[model samples]
Target: MLDRRNMLKTLGAGAAGGLTLAGAAEAEAALTAQASEALGPYARPWSPPNDKDPHAQNIVALSDDYFVPGRFAGKTVIVTGCARGMGRMAAIRLAREGANVVGVDWLADEGRAVIDGIRRDGGKAVFVPGDVSENAVCDRMVATAVDQYGGLDAALNNAGVMDAIYPGDPIDYDKQKSLIMARIDQASDDYWDVVMRVNATGVFRCLRAELRQMMKQNRGGAIVNVASVAGLRGFGGTPSYVASKHAVNGLTKNAAIDYAPYGIRVNSVCMANTATPMVERAMQILRERARATGEGGGIGMIKTKSLLQYSDQHARDSTPAEQVAVMLFLLSPESSNLTGANYATDGGFTTY
Candidate 1:
C-alpha cells in the first residue's frame, strides 16, 4: 500500500537517515522511475524521433528557454482538441513542464500520436478519444484525469468547429459559398446548429464537468476556454462562429464569478487568425473563391480583408506556440489574480 504520499514520506526519511546525500538522491530517482513505469509505457521515456518521423513533424517543439522546468510539476491537466493545432501544442508544453496530461479529441489516431510524442519526450500523458460535444465524453475526460493522476488541477477547453459539418457528398459550391460568405439571413439551420453545438455548447459541457470535479476536490483549479477575436466584436460572414465565440466568453465570465469563492479561476484566450489546420483550411477556401472570381493578390489580399481585418500588426498569422504561451500563463499560478478575462491574443487586431 505504498501510495504517493507514503512514498514521498519514505524518500524524506531516507534523506535524513545514515545514507549519504548522493545515495538518497539515487534512491529517490529509482523510485520515481519505477512509479512512472508502473503507470504505462507512455509514462516511460523513449528515444527522440528523427526529423523525418511523422509524429515528430506533428509535434510543435518549443525552445527550452520558453519552459519554466517543472512549473506544473505534479499537476494534472485536461486538454480538449489535443489532436492538432493549439490544443496539441498546449498539451505537449504542459507535459514538458511536468504536468500529467489527459489529452482528449475525436480524432483518435492523431490524438494518440500527440500523446505518444509527449511520452517520447519524457513526459506523462494519456489520450481519450471522443467528441467534446457529448456530455458523457466531457465527464469521462475529467474522470480520466482524476483516476490517472490523482485529481484535476487545470484544463484548456480548446475543441471547436469554425465551419458547418457537410454531408459525405461531393463539394456543394452553392452551400459552401453560402456558409462561408453568408449573413444571418442566409445561414442555414444546420450550419448554425452544428457550429453552436461543438463550439458553444461543447465548451459549456466541458466547463460544467471540470468545475464540478474541482469543487469536489475543493483545492481549486484553473480553466482556459479557447474563444476567438470574433467573440470581442462582430465578424462579417461568420454568424454562427461569431455568436458561438461570444457564448464562450459569456460562459467564462459567469463561471469565473460563481467559482471565485471556491478558489477556481475561469478565463478565455480570444485569439485571432492563428496558423492552425483550421485556419489553413479557411485560406484554401478563400483561395478557391478568389480563383473563381478572378480576384488578384492571391492569399495575402484575401487574408487581410477577411482574417486579419486590415491590421498592420496582424500582417502575419500567429503560431500555435504563441497562443499556447498565453493559455499556459492563464493556467499557471502566475496569473493568480486574472479571472473572467477575455484575453486578446489577437496581435492587436482588436485594438481598432
Candidate 2:
C-alpha cells in the first residue's frame, strides 16, 4: 500500500502544472512508465476500468476510492454488528481494500444495505442476519466464512452494547444522566445481564468460533476485538458497561496468549467518545438536559469532560473511520509483532 501510494505521489508530482499541457501529459506518461518498470505495473485493484456502463460508473462513484487497494486481497473477513456505525464502516473499508467480507448483524435491512453497497462498489460481501449474543449465531458467522469464502482470514468482533437506563422522559437529560450514573444498588439484574451477555459473553463466543477455525486452517489469522475505554479504568456512572468492557479486555489478553503458538494474533482496540449513533443520541440528550436546567453550565459543561480527562483538540471525539484505521492496522500483517496488546485508540482520553 505504501509503495503504491508513493508511486502515485511521484507520478502526480512529476506532472508539473507550470509546464504546457502537452509537456505535462508527456511528463506524466514518462513517470508512469518508469513507475511501471520499477513497481511492475501500477494496479488499481479497488476500481474497475472506466467503461460506458452506467451501473459500473455509479458503483465507482459511491465507492471509497481514497484507500490503497490489495491490502487484504484474497482474504475473507468476518465483521460483526456491521449494519451501522463502526462495524459498517470497517466492513466497507475492508471490502474496499480487497477483502471478501461476511457481515453479521441483527438488523436485516440495514445489514443487507451495507452488503449491497459493497457489491455496488465492485467489492465482495454477504450479510448474515442474527444476534451475536447467541452461540449458534456466532458459530454460523464463522461457518458462513468457510462455506462462502472457503476459509476465514480475519475477523473484527465489533458487536457490543451499552447499558442504557432511561428514566421515562427522552428529552430530560438530567433524568437520563441520573439513570446512566445510577450505582449498582440502583441497577437491576436484567440491566447487568443484558450488558454482560452482549458485550462480554457474545465476544467470548465469537472469539471461540474464530479461534477454532483459524486453528483448523493452520494458515494463521488476525482478530481485533472491539473494546471500550471503559475497560481500561473505572469511570463510574455505567457500572455494567465498564465491567463488561473490562471482561472483554481480559478475554482478549487470555486468548492472545493461548493462540499465539497457532499464529493467531488477538488484540483489542479500546476507543472512547467516538461519533457513533449511540454517542450522538447521548450528546443530544445531554444538550437538551442543559437547556432544561438553564443555569451556569449544567450537563453542557461536563459533557466533554465526562468522557475524557482532557478537552483539547487532541482529545476530540474520533470518527468511525478513525477507529477503523487502527483496527485495520491490527488485522493486517503490519501488526504481526503486536499481540496480546490492548491498543487504546482513545484520542488521549485515557492518557491521564
Candidate 3:
C-alpha cells in the first residue's frame, strides 16, 4: 500500500508516524490542531484532519467510517475506461461521494452499466462512448464534463490494454516476445504505432488536456494515471505493455513536478493484475502454466508467484480496488501536500 517514499507521508499522517483504524478519530483531532497552525486555520474538507474520515464510513468497509455525503458534491471527475474494471469502480464510488461523474469508453454496452449503476445509486453520471486514444474523444470528454457537470475537479487516466494474444505462463517469455514482434512486423506501420500511441502517448494527451483545463479554469485539481507495475520493473516478456507503462510512470512523475506550481497534483498507481477481463486472460495463461509446472501461483502473479493459492479464498485476502482508490484520495486534495508519488496497490507484490 505504502512504499519507502511514502514512509514520510504516512508518518506525517498520524501520531508518532502510525495510527490504526480505531485511532483515526483521535489522531485526526491532534492532526487538525497542528495543521491549523501550519496552514493558517483553513477548513478545506480535503485537509489532513478531515482526511482521516472523508466520509462517515469507509464505503469499501461498511460501518467503519461514517459516510460523508457529498464530499465531492458538485465536483466533476472524468474516468477513462469507465466501462469496466478499476476505472468503473472509481467512477461509481466517486459519484456516490457526490461528484458528477463522466464515464468514457468505446464499449457502450458495458459503459452504460457503469452509468446505470451510478444513477441507480442516486448519483449523477453520464456515459460517453469513444476511443480515449483519440484526442478528439479526449477533448469531447473534457468538454462534456465541464458542460454537463459544470467544471472539472479530478481526472483518472485509467484507459490502457496489454497484449491480449500473449498470455502464457512464464509468459512463455520468449514465445510471447516473438509473437508480439511478429504481430508488429505483419501489421501496417499505423498498427504498431497505434498500440504504443494509445497506451502510452494517449496518457500524455489526456494529462496535457486535463492540465490545460484545470489551469485555464483556475481551479486547483488532481489527476491520477493508472500505470501498472510493468512500468516499474522488467516484466517476463510483455515488451509493449512494459514499455508503455514505463512511459506512463515517467509522464506521471514529470507532470507532478511540473504542475506543482500550478496547484495541480498528479500521481500514478502502480498496480498488479486484478480479476478484470485483461487480467483474467493473463490469469488463464498463467493457470495453464501452473498446471504444466505443478506449482501454485499467488493471487496476482499468474505465471508463477507462489505466495498464495489462486482460489476465491485467496483473492479475498489480497488488496481490492477500493484500497487503490484510497491511494487516489491521498493524492487528491485530501492529501493536498502529497504529489509526484507512485502508490503500489499490489498487496506486497511490489515490495516482494
Candidate 4:
C-alpha cells in the first residue's frame, strides 16, 4: 500500500535531481555523443507508440488497484497541439477513459495518426489540423468538437512554440545562466512577436472560442493552459517566451473570473522542466553547443539542478503523464471548487 507521498517519492526519485560534478561529467559525455542525432527541425517525425493498445503508454497500469479509471468518461474534449508530446499523450489518455476527443494541431499527418490510433482502440476522436494563431482556425476547432462529439466539455490549450532561434550553449555555468536569463534589450521585436503570437495570442483565441461554446451550452467547462515554469518567473535567455507565458497566466486568471458565474473554470498548469519533445530537442542542441565550446559538459546537469533545487524530494520535475493527471483532475468535476489557479507542476521549483 503505497501512500500518495510514497508514490510520488518513488516516481520523482527516478527522474529528479540536480547536478553533481561527477554525475555531470558522465551525463555530458553521453549527451554530447547523442547531440548529432538531435540537430534537426524542432518537429520530431515520431509519435507515441501504441497502435495496438492505444493506452499502453499509461504510466500507471489500469489494472492497478489504485487506478481510478474513466474520470472523463462520456465527456467531450478539445486538445490542441495533439500532434506530439504532451498533447498527444493527453488526447490518448482522455479517450481511453471514454471521452470523445477532438485533437487539433498543425501537423496534419501526425495529428490524423493520433486520431486513427484512438479510433483503432475504440475511442472516439477526430483530428483538426490548423494553426491556433489564426482566429478562424480556433473557431473551426471548437466547431469540430461540437459537430463530431456533440459538444465540448473541456479543453487543453497546450500548443506553443519558442523563438525560431532558441539559444542554448556549452558555455561556462555562469555564462550559460546569463545567456538563458536574457535581458529585454537582447531580445528582438521579431522574437517577441513570433513567441507571443503562438504562445499568448493563440491561447487567447482558443480560450475565447472554447468559452463561447461552453457558455452557449450553459453546462460550464474547464480549460487548462499549458503554461511553463517560465510563466511563473523570469528566465534569462528567452525573454519573449517568458513574457508570452506570463500573458497565458494572466488570461487564465482573468478568464476564470469572467466565466465563473457561467460555471466555466479556467486555469493554467505551470511546468518547470518536464521532459517533452521540445525540451529534448533543445537539450540536444545545447549539448552540441557545449561540445563546440569545450565546456565541462555540465550544461544539462545544471538545468536539471535548477529544477531539482526547488523540488528536494524529487530528482526531476513532473512527467507529461503526471501533468496530464493534474490537468484531468482540473477539467473533471472533481475540481469544481478550484478555479483561476496557476497550478505549479514544477516539482516545487517556485516554493523557494
How does each model score on lDDT? Answer: 0.79, 0.75, 0.65, 0.73
lDDT of 2 by residue, 1-352 (tens): 2233344445456655354678656544554454334333222222353444423221111122244356798999999989878899999889867799999988788889999988876678988988788989999989999999999999999987665442123445454444442357666676677778888999999999999999999999999999988899765446788899999999999999999999999999998788787677656654564466553333323444423324232444677876887899899998899999898888676675
Task: Name the 10 consecutive residues with the lowest summed lDDT in model 1.
Answer: 38-47
lDDT of 4 by residue, 169-274 (tens): 2325333333332347655566577778889999999999999999899999999999988898866556778889999999999999999999999999988777
Runs off by more than 4 Å, candidate 4? 1-67, 165-183, 288-317
Off by over 4 Å in 2: 1-65, 164-181, 284-315
Residues forming the 10-long window of minimal summed lDDT in candidate 3: 56-65
The stretch of ten residues in a row with the least summed lDDT in candidate 2 is: 56-65
| Each candidate's clash count | 0, 0, 9, 11
User: Which candidate should be chosen as best, given lDDT against the real structure?
Assistant: 1
Q: What are the per-residue Cα lDDT tens digits for candidate 1 across 1-352?
A: 1233344556567768767878767655654554444332222121354444424222222332244446799999999999889999899879867799999998888899999988776678999999899999999999999899899999999998777643222344545765553457767787788889999999999999999999999999999999998899877667898999999999999999999999999999998877798787666665665667665443323334323334222245677887898899999999999999999988677675
Measured with C-alpha atoms, the lDDT of residue 339 in candidate 3 is 82
Question: What's the TM-score of every candidate structure?
Answer: 0.76, 0.73, 0.68, 0.72
Give the C-alpha miss distance for residue 304 in model 4, angstroms.
Answer: 5.0
Candidate 1 vs candidate 4, TM-score winner: 1
Error of 4 at 209 (Å): 0.6
